[model samples]
Target: MKKLKILILLLTAAISVSAQGFEHFVTAKGNQLMDGDEPMRFFSWNIPNLNYVEDEMEFGRTNPYDLPTEFEMRDAFETVKRMGGTVIRIYTIPVRNTDFPEDAVTFVEAPGEFNEEAFKVNDMMLALANEYEIRIIFSLLNNWPWMGGRPNYAAFRGKDKDEFWTDKQLIKDFKKTVEFTVNRTNTITGVKYKDDKSILCWETGNELESPYSWTKEIAAYVKRLDKNHLFMDGFFAIDGRTTVMRESLADPNIDIVSSHHYEPNPIKMMKHIDNNLRVVKGQKPYIVGEFGFASTKGMEAVMQKIMAEKDIVGGLTWSIRYHHRDGGFYHHSEPLGNGIYKSFHYPGFHSGLVYDEKDFLDMYRRYAFEIRGMEAGVDEAPNAPKLLEIVESHDIRWQGSAGASGYHVQRSESAEGPWEVIGYNVSDAAIQTFANFHDESAELGKSYYYQVLATNQGGESEPSNVVGPVVYEYQALVDNWVNYGKAFDSKDIELVTGDDRSFKEITSRAKGKKGSEMLYHVEGELVGFKVYAFEENPDTSSLKIEISGDGERWNEADTQTEVYASKEKNYAYQVPKFYQVSEGENIRYIRISFQDVAQIARVELLYK
Candidate 1:
């Protein structure tokens, strides 16, 4: 009886450990990544906004830099899982730049100071990574000024950009960042980041253009601090430098060697990959850290080369952006090679047809499974979407599901009962910065509850949380730049149409110079007006709205607008401004003058 009791206790302890601990940590074994006994290979994506964001250019939002919410982090992981991706590389941890706004949030506030709130955001991401069974490669810094990096560090000490590679104080400051990140404990899961298995490796930086001395120093420091995770050499411009690459592979501290390939020609890209592979074939694992923006066939050819080469571990596409917690997917327009390809969303959409987005995504999904020697099958149903807000009978927005391609909106008289489908196969990606579906057939006098179901190739999700009892009262004169002269007229303004590549709508911009104006004629009494405007540089651009009973005379309307700015050069950040009319006032015409270069996306005139 005592022996039996001992066996029972031992079994219980084993079960407890199994339940609490992760299965395995990814380890390096002679040019291959191993997950326990099996080799690990992945065809994944670079999720730049995983830890920090540079592309939160949404409508009505002033600040672009934001910490990812739990909903957003989960959506990213879930999307990776559905894509059959086992790994993702997050962009660098951000540092403060002198050019940023004083109120901007970043991970490293000063040399030794850190932002706890930003680190908490990373904590949630690591927790969700473990839950979703996906691995992460955490890049430590950036080479460019998009987010602060070596130059910023140099600026901190009043040194030149190249001095970052040689200056002792600048290097020490960078090491402080590394040590803080590696030694910190996750606040949510009670696991120290150094000991967590979710991290696949620690990259020195994103495309660092440093000398061998700096690379060797940083690699040694990272390996000394964290023994569990592997180290990757994040050198920039991998243009067939086999001798330099061979030397990097020989370093004991550097466990992985990677290259970023943006070559448009598939033949040249393959040659470069082959040369790099030959240098590190049996010494260490090699990966194409970032690759894409080629023709569909060109990209396919490059992916095929990676799969054919046994020594090459895997490749991560340039990037993939996910749905925002607010409503729509985060977007970034790559301003290279004709500036056509934007960041890709899952399951593809019609707006991205110029880049063969749907076909390329389909090919990626197939190759993701093929590289693992598994057959691509049906995916699971997406999680239920969240109905965000209902402005009126026509304007309804919702937070989109991760892998969902389209949505089904249903309506009913009561909150709980039989529902009728009002929208079928409505795409959330059709609209940019927000996911919306219009109820064109809603009765004028009826108040009804509404719910949404997300759908894809797999299946349909359960109904979303009910939102409603919205009554159609006032008819809003909504002009999404489509009805230009019907309800509004403009002076020195040009209606820009066609594939703008950012939003699926028309826009009107100043033609020659500043002081271009738009005049809207309202039929009935005006309650208020909401205007969506885009400014490349909000610091230099201004929009003034005025009201008038007669076209000749005008008075400045009392307006409420948010202050907007961005560090991005030539990025058209968007924000909405609202102007309320005084009660019992005879207001019929509204005039808006644009200062500097500004574009208007939409205007809604509410009337009684």
Candidate 2:
């Protein structure tokens, strides 16, 4: 069996190399991707929803703000360029969910049925990518059924989801989708799909949990269709990624080894990098197809190691958020924090939002240059300090972290203001006193907002927790809020103080479920609520609003009463909707969720 495998590999290698006849092609030399002789090491990320459309289907999972526009693609590619990225991974197939058949707007509606309208989405994507001079790693299939995945295809063939991994009939049917996509013409650009230089490679699937032999079959099949591009396995580096990569690389059809890393422990992330380096040392060219942070811990360390390794081609972050998308500001992958902005699938290209974005962009820019064998970049991003105390209208105090070289302060008169830096190097002892920075400019008669950010060589971290137009003495306090009950974790309501329900506040976007109501206790009576919200799909979602006192029971008059949102409240909305609680009725607790998928932009409780 071993001898037969070796014999097959040799023949496959000869065929793949000779079949290449394109202007730009990517081939793997040991531990390096070379374009003929010029090495290709990339800094990249994934836009799983690149060829996406809001056809009222959840084929591509969306957020409150979805980037389903063609210009959004332009904005995304521009962002990639700005971040110093040259390549990106995009999902070519929109896996259909069996549960929502109406939402099945995929390349293949049924087996062998090519949807031209749907496939045109890919045409536009490639055209846009070509314009940007950015390359794509198109993921052809998915392991999960969220997007009409392997199971959807298998079920269409009258087989179980598990059958997709081993059944020949199922595999053959999947290959049809591959053959169709690999050969389809890009009508928009007047170019053949297989001839497009925008495509870097075709991944077998996204995070497949199938057998090693199955990946070999698909990888081999994709190679026969398009020899111009390399192939990769979607095997996540969790249990036996190293071993599976070795096994997959043995097939000459498989040109690159792709691994995923999401370890939060700095030590584990560091170790993962070392092992990835060791595994691909003399064997195959490797790239971390995906690595990300749900939070800020250990991410810098992980990035530092990935960038430092010479053998590793480069790493791609989990995703890039596009403009005007469904999810609000960022993906809800982890607890939303300063640097923990879903590791960079930013929601939109809209400017003026105070995301410590420069620091994030700087990190990628530096590493992108690093992979190209070029020396570039300045300071690593510093850690943001925690705001400890607000001494009324006078001094603002905070605590610094190890990574930050200094801290900068900005004060605003309103939530949306022309902010000015009040202090710099506040955390740097040599430059100024650490932690305690006096706001000499604070005026007692007017309200003032402040933002504190930590800075280092790479850039500045996200603003501190106490970003404020902080209310001074009983100016309707919005402090003390928590996630009472919800399907997903949301930010504290106190993070939202201003009337502007923009994307910056962590509490802006919250989720609700069918028949599940969320609870929250505010410091004051809820005279009214300004729930800036919208349905993911108005047709599928509905609103249910109710309030309570002490969070246990409903208003004194009615326990089951609900204030259904008016027609105008379905999509774009304004602030608080007041409810007459009848004199002395409890209005301290706000209970709101939905009958289906929904987004709470900014939950504001009006104190009487």
Candidate 3:
């Protein structure tokens, strides 16, 4: 019996040591995230709703979203574990529902009290993460009020939302919550929550636009209680250029440089990564904590190459949603779904809506694995495109390269000798549509040799087949183009629209929902629409564009899929403007409802 007891004690010690060692707690080592001697690299997921629960009837929340059952939570983590995912980023705080307008369930229920159920759910979340060997980054708060964020926190202290950073009492209250959360004993492991190894880092909040001092203070507070884990400043490029980025990068307590990206242009996306990498300056590793497009687009290669070449720590896609609960592959997300989805859910892809679908998750896995050092065959030499036209003049068209960003249309006097750049950045188009390129240098009907080469971040592809001694002529893109007057011109269109009141008199509200007036009259095959934001960029989550006929019943537009607002105010450059063919029934009224009342700029419609 003595021998058996001694053996059992040895095994327990070994187990404890193993967990501690693997917590491997990552630290920045000259731009590389290192764990012990082995470099720490990962492909992770941003699961904003991992701990979300159906609003308990007593909370007065009336949240329509369903919470994942304990079993579902296990399955979710298990699936991530199987998919080569090393980390799971989850939201630890749930705040007010900005859209529906209600109280929300939060880890910190009040000034000094913690929600019993919320904590229990987190205990389960941490345990499951530990069981699956997945590390977690817990975000403590939110920027927007959707999750009862800063606003809710301040309201609880009887202070204005902006006072969250400066109010001494409020800051102290924040420390109390932080102390309780980090020091609280885990119900599952019997180990204190802060001491557990499953947690990777503590984030101050989700893209919060708060003061840098507040972040430093909170991070200091957290470190005082639990010195084991790393800290992250949830600094986002929202509002105008501010000290947020500099403060975050220079802060000693913050361990990682995290930037969220949503740019569609590949060139811009790569640059965004570069900008983030530049700030780290080798003192810390960087991660694109969030980024997304409806599809792989052409990122499979760009992301893998940059991560490996730049020695980036890792990337967490915008989100992963429960297959069964959050609407399947084809389910519509908030702002309402666009009969067809691009995979980003309603909330966090900027406006919080990030969920799953079969193809989308598979794409996520493809990039995830690629980022983890798996070889993806995206760098192979692209096949030479077959030039669709034999042209010697300025106007020309050709096939697109499979993995190319743009093409170089070259001009040569000989069929086999030298080629000069006639045009470049000729955009890549769909497989079925030929790319159009023009050379202003070409004389009409001139005999010239032309060959095109595909270009991408990877490198240039083999020159396309030569098309020579061909004559070409300029083709006008449009004939007799006319600018129809704005939506205010009632005589030019069927509907006369105004919001709440005349556009000039309206004062924009940063919070709560604002609405646009209805334009009613007649209807033509309502062809397309153009719109932009007015002044300061609005919150991406706060906008609704609906078409109502008879000034009564209404339907939302597909373009609304992209809210005019983004977490980064300037990324939106101008208001959200788009032109698309209208679907559904013809309506008499057009109305728009969204947050950020001041963001509206202009709206115009075109019809024949």
Candidate topping TM-score: 1
Find the number of clashing residue pairs for candidate 3. 27
lDDT per residue (tens digit) for residues 107-200 in model 3: 6667777777777788888877777878888888777665557776788766788888899987877777777778877676655778777788
TM-scores of the candidates in the order shown: 0.87, 0.60, 0.54
Off by over 4 Å in 3: 1-23, 54-62, 65-67, 96-105, 238-244, 323-360, 374-608
| Top of the candidates by lDDT | 1
Listed per model in order, the count of residue pairs whose N, CA or C atoms clash below 3 Å is 0, 27, 27
lDDT of the structure predicted as candidate 2: 0.59
Worst 10 residues of 3 by lDDT: 475-484
**Residue range 70-135, candidate 2, lDDT tens digits:** 655765776576566788897548644455434335566777887787787788888888778788
What 10-residue stretch in candidate 1 is worst by lDDT?
503-512
Please list the residue runs of candidate 1 whose C-alpha ends up more than 4 Å from where it truly belongs after superposition.
1-21, 239-244, 440-445, 482-493, 497-524, 535-598
